[model samples]
Target chain A: MHPINRRDFLKVASFGGLVFASGLSGCASRAAKSEADEFYFVQLSDTHWGFQGAPNPDAKVTLPKAVAAVNALDPQPDFIVFTGDLTHTTDDPAERRRRLAEFKKIISELKVKDVRLMPGEHDASLDRGEAYKEFFGETHYSFDHKGVHFIALDNVSDPAARIGEEQLAWLKADLAKQAADARIVVLTHRPLFPLFPQWDWATKDGEQAIELLMPHRNVTVFYGHIHQEHHFKTAHIEHHSAKSLIFPLPAPGSQPKRAPIAWDPAQPYRGLGFREVEAEHDEYKLTEYPVVKA
Target chain B: MKRRTLLLGALAAAMGSARAEPEVIRIVARKFVFEPAEITLRVGVPVILELTAPEVAMGFDAPGLKLNTEIPPGKPVRLAFTPDRPGEFEFVCDVFCGSGHEDMGGVVKVLP
Candidate 1:
């Protein structure tokens, strides 16, 4: 783990980036020893591989371009996680499976060995995630990396956009084993809070899940579903939504409907991007990168 | 003035009678489509949508109409509302049923 030197810190700070670092501990001020524990993971979401529409004409190459971009990282991310929506929704079961398979094959090219995946409603809700599970293993699971406990919750599987009672129980049991101030990161496909319920931008029982995590002091949630980068907070827990790889959607309730913003001919892939989340203990620094360089 | 008051009372009574019973429409929700996908209704007329999911749990959400409900398997879920405006509104099976769930939506055309 290379310590971020003053030059590297200056370079990131010059870009007026790391907006998430606000109100949290300063990354530059931390001791080099503590920086040794700092590790970042790449988050790419809503690839919607099989999608073909006006929103993104280059859908076929977007995922591959993103994979190439991630592979170009100086020291590759500790791991890579696709928040959800691995494939476009399809009515045919065989086609759905094929899309998932194709999506998996594309991501396999990532240089990162430890790649984690979850499902968005598009990839799951149809068969209650039966096909998604066949490809991605489990819709929701947890793991530990460098003292940070990461929990991936599946809010898309139930179709009603719920984390469900069973998963809530699992979350409760999982949190019970952790300290109140334990560094925890939650990954989900839908916003756990009611960002825009009318547009289905909410998880039906997400409030219940939030209640379960409220007791913990150091909990941050990263999700992807709205297909654009958004930030919110439910008390102390900070929720950040990632941009989709395929296209972008209007801001929460900004429009009467939640349709994909039309692709721009001059500025292709304008609102599509991925993120790198650097975790130094409980504090995080998020840096966004466009799908393609400007 | 007395005649006008009598006429107003009769109009109120007629409106009351209209509200006494609402038109019921039954909609069946399957894997990826809603039966009777396009429905037409009159503005100011009260309607009760009897929604059912024959195979699995589903949802009826028409945000424009402010009607949303869960249609549990083997049970019918009824939602009642009066179309206040005249326009084409959309109601979708918000619950994930299968692969085509995203396209499982119907339009409710409320005639003025």
Candidate 2:
């Protein structure tokens, strides 16, 4: 804010993001929606709602800014999905509830008709989404959206942070039940394959997840724990890390302390924000936009 | 009544002959770092660090102070230490914070 007022910059920045969203209009608009091209969901990850720290003066502003960015997209998503870390620390149950309530308030401001949610380690750090599920829905479940089979896995539980034996089994059976031609999309808080175990990432049992999804022809894994955006391919499956609405984290093993990537005072909210995932015709397009410049 | 009062006064005087107990030092926390990072206290004084945070998890970490405790956000946690030697001790926030996190450091000063 020293160089420019935050709110003023936010207005200009948000307009810029909207402009960017509109500018990307070309590559995406050609993707045309169809009964076969039917699956589309927004990825909103790492919204550490209750984070209070010096990394950013307005921890409060970052989340709302991301939501505004998401809402500004021209083609409204079929539904929006929050990847996880609904709150920070995850110590107090009341604090968790309070933060989730605030999350709802912020999301309520959005015009998107449908929204789905999942938990990351921060939100479920202590209680493992016991409170999150109470407010949202089942942590790991699956549904179908326009000829595509969608599965949301719970991978932020306990130290191992696996999809759990039960959820993995459910995923295998769910995939087995789907038609061979159906597009498969898996959602979880952590990346399925090891992105950076040194950073306490990579699910211990993610290999099982990878094996299960490998059989599918076209499968895209959606995850949100890393905060910084990244994409990797393991065994024919597409894995992606979503940006957090909270503070950005350093790359895995980037620092010796093993702490999260901190905020950059000069480039605050740089790679931290939201993305629009549109599956249409023959391809899936993920267009990312920063919240601050939104 | 005079005899009873005299007996009570004598008992109180006898109890006062014991050595003095140690004093405690308190430190409060919120958001990122602890308050009064450089705590000054007697070598034998019991330094009781009362760390409080709203929703950001933080810890009271100090090696010279020989103290470390992870205080999950929203709850107040207390860390107690008694530095045997008098010198400079360092404290840091173990929780990963953005940007100014490395700066979320503190110091403890022990007196002879």
Candidate 3:
């Protein structure tokens, strides 16, 4: 693992020549930058700890590598957020517990101050996330840090993808406290929009959640579950889905069915990667890093 | 009277044949959703449900009728079963496809 300093962190953070709505380099130039000036966070999703298959022969190996990659990040991130699917699908109660426990034990190796987790259908929908919550606490909640409001929602907790009237009301009440101009980031397992109903990629009642968020001026959503990198612009909100730590799925409707792409021995961990987001007040820049260095 | 008895026998045999032959319904499962999301059939009649996915591998699971099968992309799997009662049986894609795996399901309505 390459040890990263603040300089090395900024060098990689400004990747791809991607520009934000505002200038982030200027924030980086300041010697004593305030917390709101610049901060970075890492997103790791779809680890699928218990997944054992041809698509990912070393599925377990990639996770520790991901943790080490984050730990090696220069300046380190404020925290690490795992989008969802900590474990593969399982119905047996004991197996479910075992998988969750194993996933927790493995992810605990991350050298970060805090690690936030959500749930994918594989982790939660079967038992309505009871097993997941028992390990990770509330599947959906909110917090504030460095003038940014972060909301974690559990759309997969219910197999039907219904957020329920209760959670919606809670969200409304939560948002009402924040000013309209507050920087907000929403996280979930599935795409909140109806990206493709046939594949279960959409939240059953996500429009309601979107409607509540529409009022916010600065809001971005980072989600996982699609197991690929995708960007969408809807109603002044930017939705980004990160790549999986395990395997990648076919593009939506690109094939007759949705299945994990077979792994290539020549290019191991080809589509498996994670994302780093650098936030500065109202602006945020994102860069995806593959588990295997190019 | 003999002619009337023959006529009655022929009518009963025709009905029996109709009951024995189930209607065929073809369903396609793709990313996140199923084509022909809802299907309706009559009770006491057998059905040949032809399930196929043109893209990747998927599965059809209707526990109510004890019907479950893996559907390979572009390969059709025919399931033959008779509806013994009238009700709606929900069938889900038992196989994981992607993020939308959970939403890949529809209702099989058995009508009286």
Give the candidate number with the greatest lDDT. Answer: 1
Model 3: per-residue lDDT, tens digit, A32-86?
Answer: 5466556888988999888888999998799989888888888899988999988
- Write the residue-wise lDDT of candidate 2 on A1-294 in tens digits: 011112221122323432111111123333455455555578888888888877666798888877787777777888898887777754467877998888888889888867878887776645756777778878888887775678888887542365778888888888888754457778888877767544446676889988877766677788888777666667456677787787777776576444555567778776677877767655566666778562
For candidate 2, list the clashing residue pairs, or say none.
A13-A293, A14-A294, A85-A120, A249-A261, A250-A261, A262-B98, A263-B98, A263-B99, B38-B107
DockQ of all candidates, in order?
0.42, 0.03, 0.06
* Candidate 2: CAPRI quality band: incorrect
Q: Which model scores highest in DockQ?
A: 1
Q: Candidate 1: where are CA atoms >4 Å away?
A: A1-19, A22-33, B1-20, B25-47, B53-57, B62-66, B72-75, B80-91, B98-100, B103-112
Model 2 spans > 4 angstroms off: A1-39, A260-262, B1-112
Put down candidate 1 lDDT per residue, B1-112, tens digits, no spaces: 9999999999999999866878899999997788989999999888899998989888888878888898999999888888999998877777877656655778899999
Per-residue error for A205 in candidate 1, Å, reads 0.6
Task: Report lDDT per candidate.
Answer: 0.84, 0.69, 0.80
Report the C-alpha displacement of residue A266, candidate 1, in angstroms.
1.1
Estimate, for each residue in B1-112, the C-alpha lDDT of model 3 and write its tens digit.
Answer: 9999999999999989867666789999997788999999988777899988998777787767778777888899999988898898777785566556655788889899
